[model samples]
Target chain A: MSAVALESVTVHAGGKSIVDGVSLSVQPGEWLSILGPNGAGKTTLLRVLAGTIGFRGEAALRGRRIRRLHRRDVARLVALVPQTPVVPHAMTVAEYVLLGRTPHLSLLAQEGEDDRTIAAAALARLDLEELSGRELGSLSGGELRRAVIARGLAQAAPILLLDEPTAALDIGHQQQVLELVDRLRREEGLTVVAAMHDLTLAAQYGDRIVLVDDGRIVAEGPPAEVLTAERLASLYGAQVRVLFDGTTPVVVPVRT
Target chain B: MTAAREHGLPAVSAPHVGVPWTLVALAVLAGAVLVGLLVGPVPIGIGPIAGSALAHVPFLDAGTQLEAAQEAIVWELRFPRVVLGALVGGMLALSGASYQGVFRNPLADPYLLGVAAGAGFGATLVIAYGPTGVDGFVLPLASFAGGVAAVAAAYLVGRSVGGGRTTATLILAGVTVAAFLTAAQTFVQQQNTESLNEVYTWLLGGLATSGWGDVLTVLPYVAISAAVLLVHRRTLDVLAVGDEEALALGLDVTRVRLLLVGAATLGTAAAVAVSGLIGFVGIVVPHLVRLLVSSSYRVILPLTVVVGAAFLVLADVLARSILSPAELPIGVVTAFVGAPFFALVLRTTRSSA
Candidate 1:
């Protein structure tokens, strides 16, 4: 069954159509990357899917209209790991990740054993077990990004919406995070959708790519078809060279 | 890590969560309370007088002169002040913590949006001009009204700008409102120089003149407002990631914001109503509590209540007796100590967390 479906999704910001009539669908455990340039409504599209913005069209999760679902209930089914990791002061790694269990908890109920166990397990999955006791303020940017993903994992949501998940990370940490996300999908049947700026990373990890430009999907399907050198150049308005890194098509753009 | 299980308290599965810190806070509160009861300008000793003091009982009628002095001090003189301090302090601290949470800035104080400034003007009018123009309880009532009015004005201005979505705009509106209120207060105070001492002294803030009547008068409102905040702690957690995030978490952002802000305003207004205008307890106490509780309102909120009570009680003790014959306005004492200590804490911590 399809996990999340968006149809004719239109988003406006400052009276301009930022995401105009864009549509996408994801099956269970499938990975989809939404690729676009700066101000190309990449984050905005993620926000719409995350139900953080008002859009004209239908968004459904597991056949339920998104508008009808209670927000915390929706949060339980879908998690959004934003582009930036904004952690409040003095919040411990364990404590921060445990907030993912908030939807499941009653208004006054404190975190039980199962919640802690889930949070610790999620931390372990991301290799953040050692950092559980540390304050979030002390974390490196890469570690902070990992922490946010750990939080998303702790939510145990079927659908994960990530906005520029690897934007601030070093290459090593980027690979570690992406590989962990992929592993989560394969092992736990989690649907992953990331708004990605790097065409190479998008083509590398995504099972399918949706190319968006000027708030609309210019092309969609296999990375090979959607990430053509000619299309990349025209869409981003930059000089770009596309090469096959073994099975994956990688795009390297040169500023003109 | 389910490590500790005690009988009286709920078995805390999350040992690292706020349980231990809360115990520590309770211990400090007890110590502060004891100190407040025992110490005064008149030194009460341990051995001879202490023994005689213990001799007094309900059935035995062994009450001594020492017991009378103790009663006079504890019940008559110091208790009301300490109780008011604790109540007002707790109110300010909780409101501050919640305000900072709502704004998503640690720097945001409880009085951020001109409540104190406008209330200052209203209070100045009452103190300088006297309640002859109005009726009984007019001063505090006017001050409370002004506090609510100021926040309402700021909120309206912010909504007009962008539905309170923009922090910069909200803060700017608050500043404008404050400036306007301050100007009005200055003009009024200048016109009434005959009561300048009264006006300025009230503005500095203290619990010196407030007796049991003032304490009883302000207690219910502050307590109710604080209780309202405590009940809505979880909704505040949703607000930690900004309104958009909280909205996605199924909270009616606008309504919750209004409720939370209103609760804060009510609590702060009550505190101001009783104590005049004590500042920074709201900012400092919550930050300190967050330091101990690690930023959970579940932790910060209750801890702030205990710690704030203890802090204000201690500060009042210092304010009253530090100069013997003359007393400092509790606000001055707190600011003098709080400002330097705040700078030190900021310098030491590097970042607020």
Candidate 2:
């Protein structure tokens, strides 16, 4: 069964369509990467799917229309890790992650022992146990990114939406974060939707890639089929060389 | 991995530290209240006053005797003033802390949305033009109405400006409204210089003439507002991240913002109505609690109540006794101490950041 489905979803702002009519679906436990240039409405589409914004057409989660679901119910099914979430300077790493348990809690209920255990386990998975006690202001950029991903993981939602999950990380940390997410997807049957910029990384990790440009999906298929030199040149308006290793394609920009 | 392997899972639980800190705060509040009761222009012995207070408690009796004049001074004058001070202090601090959390701005206070200026303008109007023998409720009623009106205007302006999405715009709206109201108040004061002293006294804030009726007037509003804010302590924590994240986490961000702003403003208006415009208790107490205790609102909100009560009672003590006989405005005393402490907080936070 499809975990998420959007049909003719449209978002307009300031007399311009931020997310033009777009239709897509993701099956349970599948990893879908949305690749696009800057200002391509990738974030807006993610927001639409997360039910954080208003849209014109149908958006559904787990076969139910997103608008019909309670905000808390939608939150329980989907989690979005934003591109650059604001971190409270004085908040501790553990405290920030524990906020993921909010959907499961009643209006006046406190975070119980079970919630703490889940958060602690997420911290351990992210190798953030050491920094759990540290204030957010003290974390490095990579550590902060890991903490944010850990928070998403702690939400325990079936579907995860990550926007530029590895934007600020070094190569080693990037691999670790993506690998951790991929492992979780496999082990827990978790469906993942990521809005990513790196073509190589998205091609490697994404089971399928959707290329969005100007608020519309231009191409959608296997990474090898969609990430061609012609498509790359037109989409990015830059000269690029596509290198093929076995069945995998690696994009390399051709310097003039 | 090395750090984790060495220490096992680092303690992810919120430190079980709130209880001890709360108990210490309660003790400090008790000591401050005792000092507030005993030290005044008309000296009263601690033993007899303590005994008299205990005697009044249901099912408790303490054998002590006091002169009639001393008893009247303690019961009729000092006790109500201290209680009123505590109530106003707790309301302002709690409202301030909640405002900061909701806006996710450390600079937010109870009056950030123009409650003080509104209340000042309202009081000035009453002093300048009201009948000579107005009833006790008239001034407080006008002040409360003015405060609520100001915040309402600010909220409307903020919503109109940025659809209420940005805290910066809301604060800007508040500053604009505050400036307008202050100018109006100054104009009124100039027109009625005969009532200027009364206007100035109310603007500066004091609890010199508090009675049980004054305490009773604000009690219900303060109680209800405080309860509502306390229940949303966790919600405030969610809001600290930002609106989009909070909404994504299943919180009704707009509803929470409206409820918090409404409750905080209502309580603050009631407080300012009774006690005039007591400054810094709202801004200083919550930050102090955050610095010393916990940053979580669950801890910060409850602690702000006790610590604010204690701090204000102590400040009021200094206000009345500083020069002896001639009392200083409570606002002056709070600013004197709060400015330096705020500076220290800024320096420390900056260096650490």
Candidate 3:
């Protein structure tokens, strides 16, 4: 069964269609990476799938229309980690992570012991146990990104959406974070949809890749089939050489 | 525990609790109330007054030996005035804290959206054109209506601009409305020079003539609004992250913002209606509480209420006794203290950044 299905979803903003009519579906527990250059509406599509943006067309989760679902219900099924989340300067890492338990709580209910255990476990998984009491503003870029991902993990949703999950990380941290996400997917049967800028990383970790350009899907298939040198040069307007180490294709820009 | 330690698992620290801090705040408020009751122009014996006040609490008789006039001065005038001051102060601080949380701006106050200017205009109109023989209730009712209307207008204007997405736009709308209302108030003051003193006194804010009636008038509105705001304290914590984040977290950010703004504005309107335009209590108290206590609304909101009550009661005492026999406007005292504290906060925040 498909975990998510979008039929001709479109989003308009500022007299322009940011996300044109686009249809796609993700199978249960599959890792789908959305690869596109800047200004390609990747973020907009992710927002639409997360139900945070107003969009026209049908978006369904497990055969249910997304528009009909209460926001709380959608939240219980899906979690989205934004590209650059605003961190409250004075908020502790633990408090921020605990906020993910909001959907499971009643309106006036406070966080209980069970909720605390979940949040703490998420932090521990992210190797943030020592920094749990630290203020968010005091963390480095890598630590902050991990904290945000930890928050998404604490939500315990079946489907996770990540927007530029490793934008500012070094190579080592980048590999660590992606490996962690991939491990979680395998262990928990999580359906992961990620918008990525790193083509090599996307081709490696993504079970399937969807290439988008100008608010439309240009190509959709397995990474090896979709990430061709001609398609990359045409989409990015840059000369690129595709090298393969074993079966994985690595793209590096050709020197003029 | 020993087995887990041996297994090399990370230990979870306990959450930072608020009970001990709350007890400390309660003690401070109790002391402030005691001081407020004892100090006044007409010197009253602390023992007798305290005894008389405590004697009224059923099942406990502290005993009182005081003249009728002394009892009247303590029970009838001073006690009610102090209580009214506490209520107004608490309402203003709570409203300010709610505004700050909703707008995600530290500088947002109860009057940021023009509640004070609108209420002032309303009072000015009553002083200028209302029948000379109008009762005391007329002025408060008019001002409350005016205040509510002004905020409603501000909210509408803000919504019309940017769909209320940007805090800057809402603040701009508030400034425009406040300027227009203040101009209208000035025109009324100029036209009715004879009533200028009355208008000025009301605008400057004082509890000199406070009675049980004034307290009773605003009580229900304050109670309801405060309860509503207290219930949403956790929602405010979620909002601190950002609107989009809050929405993604399953909160209806728009609906929560509207409900909170409505409750805070209504409570603020009621407070300003009774006490005129008390400056700085709203802005100063919440920031102070956040600085001294935790920033979480769960702690900030309740502590703001208690500390605001204590702070204002002390300020009222100073206002009356500063220039003995000739009372200073309570607004003047708050501004005097609040302006310096605000500057200090700005400096500290800037330096830290």
lDDT of 3 by residue, B208-250 (tens): 7545988897788889989999988999999988888888889
Instruction: Write candidate 1's Cα lDDT for A125-167 as tens digits.
Output: 8888678888788999888998888888878889998899889
lDDT of 3 by residue, A160-204 (tens): 999999999999989988999999899888999999999999999
Docking class of 3: medium
Task: DockQ for candidate 2, please give it.
Answer: 0.57
Tell me chain A's TM-score in each of the predictions. Answer: 0.97, 0.98, 0.98
Query: Candidate 3: misplaced stretches above 4 Å?
Result: B1-17, B59-62, B130-141, B152-169, B351-353
Best by TM-score: 3
> How do all the candidates rank in terms of TM-score, highest first?
3, 2, 1
Rank order (by lDDT, best first) = 2, 3, 1
Give the range of the ten consecutive residues with the poorest summed lDDT in model 2 chain B. Answer: B1-10
> Higher-DockQ candidate among 1 and 2?
2
Q: Candidate 1, which CAPRI tier?
A: acceptable
Each candidate structure's count of clashing pairs = 0, 0, 0
Query: Each model's RMSD to truth, in Å?
Result: 4.3, 3.0, 2.5
Comparing 1 and 3 on lDDT, the stronger one: 3
Clashing residue pairs, candidate 3?
none
Q: By DockQ thresholds, what CAPRI class is model 2?
A: medium
